[model samples]
Target: MAPNFSPDAVWAQCCEKLRAELPEQQYNTWIRPLPPADVQRDGDTTVLNVRVPNRFILDWIRTQYSTRLEAILASVSDGPVRLDISMAARPAMARPAAPSMMPPNAQGPHSLGTMGTALPPNALAARASGNYQGGINPLPPSAGPHTVVLSEQGEHPHNVVGLHGGQRRNGHPQVMGLNPGLTFDNLVPGRANQMARTAALHVAGAPGHMYNPLFIYGGVGLGKTHLMNAVGNALLADKPDARILYLHAEQFISDVVKNYQRKTFDELKAKYHSLDLLLIDDVQFFAGKDRTQEEFFNAFEALLAKKAHIIMTSDTYPKGLANIDERLTSRFDAGLTVAIEPPELEMRVAILIKKADQEGIAMPEDVAFFVAKNVRANVRELEGALRKVLAFARFSHKEITITLAREALKDLLSIQNRQISVENIQKTVADFYKIKVADMYSKKRPASIARPRQIAMYLAKELTQKSLPEIGELFGGRDHTTVLHAVRKIGGERAKDTELNQQLHVLEQTLKG
Candidate 1:
């Protein structure tokens, strides 16, 4: 309560508190690097301004530590205090040298030679040329019992050991956790995944040059994982020894936890930071796990500093994720973020036919169309329906036909029909946006109500077998032109607005359920 209270003293006390409460590595990585605060007074409010070296640290501190820092300031200060975090300016002449991408305990490249397959002679040149080869070094023979050997046919055992047990040959790890079967050649392209696939292909062709940390997101079974794997496979094909690893987000979390328990962060860094590319799936699972986020953040920074590419998939876009640190999410959004929408009708038909051909079954075009029309949720469902139809044809000793397809997919068709009525869509959309269902029919024009109503109209037209006039009639007798307008507006915006597209995806999934 002293009039001459020093903000520096308060900040010092806050740092001491954080140091005591947080793990040593976390405190050192995040808190100790922060510059001193510049505190001032304006209109009875004490403003504490903190500057960080970069946007990453600024976002990290603001999201993870700002509230606690503010509380500490308020507790120590006499009046209300506000926190303002910003990036510090870098002086051109005196800017600090970039930190080594190597881990703290690592001596040199030779330090890792004992752990896995030895690096090739041209490894440095390849890395500098953006053609880096090899993934994490395979564990020593004594480290594990299983040894995964990559086959020439691009097939590996289903129960292949994890990343570390892969075989070593010609001084390169043979298995980089990639499924060679999932490649760009086999992945059917469509408007739904066109943008995402293009970005992925760019990353594959020239890793770490553009779209660094490429992010792909969408609903379940919509080919997010397939796209990520395709990128890794493409890179591996170009440089057989390229260091690449593909894994789900939970696997990374497990690695973090295991290393944390063993106090072996150096090994963790050596494995992940040395890669040419990282393809991770479903990063939304990283939510709420502080230690994992911190470690992943470290790996992410190291890879980028070394110009290594990273591809991550999630059920939602970066900003749409929950319980994740702002710094990580911000980094996730730093690169190109694309969505794999549910396949369109033509694309779905194409997928069914292609997959059937791959199975050596001659799928009639009409049957493919019939299956595509009914199984509109995603490619996975489309594949499942194709399998059912194929099996029914084989067992019944008949040619593949629409009549057979209908009988095969009767249950799915019934479920689809039972769900997703216009009324159900209106109710779901209203509940999602926290508006009244009646607002869909009412003349309310506020954005909050109108947006959800328009979304409902669009879904009605897409999901139900309703024409424009019929949909309009269901929506409180609105004009067919209004219904068409809503559909067109939402359809156009859905392609451009990531947030709206995500919202619509959620509503569609809920209605389909």
Candidate 2:
């Protein structure tokens, strides 16, 4: 028999259970936006309708979390209710009150406090309008001198100041420059970034205590920004009123320039110096800018004086930063520094699969390896290739297969396969001969330069698809006859002269490598 229950009460109880069971990101991504549409009965069977924003979310929840949700609902209603999670034709209106100005993304943060003070799903992103309209579970009136400023485009949080040169009265600083989606749970750890992730976790757990100035450096798209955001999100979860600020070094420089223009140095100092945590991305931009460096140095000293946590990211290690102030570089080196290396082949394949899972895409293992093997640059390129494949599949209305991926990334794969370029060949030949790379293309007729130049021309013909004319153009615009002669001479000598054969073989391997 179907148990009689109020739909609203049953859903409320289910949400409480799911929030406790799932990770915060999982809760936010799958469950938080779900609004109960209706409950009905088909003979003895009971059904619960929950509205979703799009087909992807509906399908994801159906496949991944349906069984778990069914169990939770069964426990709450004393029997299983057929969960009818569906995509709404239009936005539903039967939701809790929210600001008129919704965030760009339909799914935003819900300030539903803890278990005892759970609110409706519509309560999500109530702070979307730059105001924290907490109806049930409200924050304090003030958190020291920091003001709760809603982040813009997940960029830096604006530090709102009060009229009395003190804290704002509206709310405490719940500033979050971190993306809600980038959490520790979603981050896959491997040998490449394990130490960085571990240190980030430590800093998140005890900010300003252990790693006062945690510095993370790595190449592009290696998850440096993601780890920093994870730390910021963890800190926010721990202390809702924590004053957190995140921005790029360019943004910091812009702030300094603007403050100087407006003659508002005092306000700028207050905004940056009183933070519980400050995060800066791509600090390599801070190099060669004296005024910006001076301003940041002052703010850095001030924040340190107050024991505020500071985390920074860069493309290079601290000492590698050229033209920067020595004092600033010294401060950067004082704290813990961690580097995230490029992921290995296995790890790349793992990242592709994990990203596909997050996007609710059913990717075959072979197809993922195909994509991973081709795009070996960094994590960014791997994801970009995967995105292209997904887009092609969606547009062509086909499932992702090895053949489909090849067709999707045909141009990208061509570029990756031709790794040996004429310029690289020139450099390799010149370096092997212990001569400057310019000597390969120079008009010098010395045997040292001429032999290496001829070998480079031969490599261009063998290792690349360039025609003789094109090869000639690359070598200081010589005629195609000169290129053909060089290739013929090298071919004949490679078989007759043992020394030349060994050198040609070594040069070929170097060019390919």
Candidate 3:
């Protein structure tokens, strides 16, 4: 029964308001065609409750439209109407007799859909039983025999041969192939990346069902992308047709720009939603680009609706995506997050030996260690260093000894070494000694500053090629002998004092890493 305030009329007005309130792309993604959730008058404030599909969508709405929502409600309602943004429940799965104790992953405030029926009863039961593991899914075909559809009721995994027949794309994704050998199996795991690798394996084995939004973060050259590809490969291996779509946040941005430019927004949405498995890399790039962030927020919800598995890799958690909308950040936090660290020395050595053997190069133990120790812990850099040494050895007909290896790749280390100028050394020492750079050269006779000043000089000598007089000049025109004395004292202390030695060792490692 329609109240004196017509529900359909209210929804129509709400839709119109949404169009006026949001950007065209956003309105189309979140509001167009989707009817308004039931509107109920609660007290003086009619609390217009809008059921959002997922927290990501809900968050995006709140961030970009919360204020507009209140105004929209104000226009439709008798007076000011408070907005109750919520994740609509699956109507097919009846509300539990008692309150359904949400699983750890579903405890978030947002739901999977705008209306309470996006998830089917079967999917809810599957989640509730905790017995069945949602296995792999096939890649989408173009209007093929078995097409997965998401509704609010019960979900049943459909197969081809008779059901919805979606066809496979002949050649849509024109992206180049990533390194075939960089899959998860090839990664040499150690303490630094053991946890991250394990999580990725779990995701690869169990797509959307295991980790709806699996997050892997680490510095550049870390195996973030490698683990992502490994999972993609594993998923593809289990289900060859698994529509595995991989793109960086930058590429996503490009797509957004193209779609917006060409007015092919529908095509863009279709292209992304069609993937059975979505793998996003360098998600951090979405932080600064608002339009790209909005596009992704929609793609995420649509895929989740179809039970499509999503794996994202980044240098920071969604929450840390600066310049990104808070709601988007919150949605990213809805999933399990794991981080990868730079490979440890042992891991690096194993990786090097593995690569060397693969390349038919017998890298000596010392050479391997030297390569592993000096180059950044990233596998790509490790491989590059190995290739350089092998090329030099192959062309010049010389074994890859420490000297030869050093000569072959002095350029890389040279720039890296040159970065730590005298000022940098002074600053690094001052930071370590809890002093200021001014104090290093200050006429102040305090031993506190003088001791640190000495270490800086010593590090400058070892790390940089600055002459003694040059080093002396950098230290406020001190005599060469004084600079030399500082270096010798710190060097001596490094040898005798374990703590001091450890600190020096750590500093040396930092300069190299």
Candidate 4:
């Protein structure tokens, strides 16, 4: 008989290593709730058993923590240790039954407005009902179609699809590609992302029945993915058993290619069409991919027919998705489309503070403001600046302060402080058009001067936060309506006149530098 081992001691040591390695929120969500079930020795290998509450977590542990947990166990044990994770037996309890495919109360906190009934497809009837095998096993599409099953090539599985006992905790299932950490509760709302966040939360509460397909568009690092994941998590909170798929368009393309090579087209259909909710990021990648778009179109229609909610993110507006099939673009625009503008000053500071809090760092308000003010590009850059400040403080054994932040981000601040003034923009545009800078602020009605000035105005509107009146004042005391007209004119022509567009793009790039 193999000797018994202490599961409690083994798990405690594992937790210690994980707590040190992961962020506090990550540790708390994925590790802290785990219970040590049992331990046994199988020949030279020591096996430690830990129990999770549901299949969702069981797979999450295997996918995310299997190797790390094994190494941690080995480091703390007498010999090599492997983990065996499984779902615990549940006590009978009443679960919030899924509501009929009826319109959710628009006045409800999460619902947006009146939407017709649209439930998930027929495949949702099939659920995963078996013990987790320490490793991922490929199950039929009916059994949680979006569930990430390893392909023997070590690619990350896309999403975990379903629930057992209709219960999950903390965040959504890692379905499709949802990140557990980007919940709606943690997302800071501001003028930039208010509408987008509101629509997302509404979709989360009602799923397919409301906001049948929510389209969120924004520039890079502006929380498009974060909002989509928050919706997925919110849906998971309500319907723990929901089959959700959150994946990038590139991932979808890759999966399609793989299936094509393997001659598994039916499986691809099953995988995507089976979901109760689909959240695809960066659908702009579908541009020029005729075959991929065809497949997606079919799946899209299938999902819509079943009333499955779909959410997609793109870096540009649906109408601006050039080189993409018009049908797909029109379909994308058919739903609730929201734009996430760049965060304003106040929102940026709040984001920095929130990120600092998540990192367990005490960032003085002034320090946060310093970093936020300088890192004005996007949330990603703001977080990066904060990380640098935190790293410097930790290494120097000093507290975070404005002085420390300045010293830590000197180079970044220098680049950020190079303001793109209207004068600089006018000069760049004039030089590019071989016209005089004086033409910018002058009433020069000549086509050459007028066109250049209009382009500059359009660029100002797109790149700066200046009000139309402020911009008009800088452009020779013109009325705000004149500025608006110039902006609209240039914007309309930007798509049609490639040379004009290129000239404006180059001028904008030079001015930003």
- Tell me how many clashing residue pairs each candidate has: 7, 0, 32, 3
Model 1 C-alpha lDDT per residue in residues 284-319, reported as the tens digit of each score? 999999999999999998888777788888887787
Worst 10 residues of 1 by lDDT: 145-154
| Regions more than 4 Å wrong, model 2 | 1-176, 418-513
lDDT, ranked from best to worst: 1, 2, 4, 3
List ranges where model 1 is wrong by over 4 Å: 1-166, 169-174, 432-435, 441-474, 477-504
TM-score of each: 0.63, 0.53, 0.56, 0.56
Question: Between prediction 2 and prediction 4, which has the larger lDDT?
Answer: 2
Tell how far residue 294 is off in model 3, in angstroms: 1.9
Mind giving the per-residue lDDT tens digits that candidate 4 earns over 202-268? 4655566544567887767889888887777767656766787778788889978899899999888
lDDT of 2 by residue, 7-93 (tens): 777788989898987645456546765776477876665677676543323334554566667667677775545666654444434
Between the candidate structures 2 and 4, which one is better when assessed by TM-score? Answer: 4
Better of 1 and 3 by lDDT: 1
Model 3 error, position 261 (Å): 2.5
User: RMSD in angstroms, all models?
Assistant: 15.3, 23.5, 17.4, 25.9
* Total clashes for model 4: 3
Model 3 TM-score?
0.56
Highest-scoring model, TM-score: 1
lDDT of 2 at 123: 25
Query: RMSD of model 3, in Å?
Result: 17.4
Tens digits of lDDT, candidate 3, 347-412:
778888888888887778899888876774366677889889989999999877999999898997
Worst 10 residues of 4 by lDDT: 125-134
Query: What ranking emerges by TM-score with the best candidate at the front?
Result: 1, 4, 3, 2
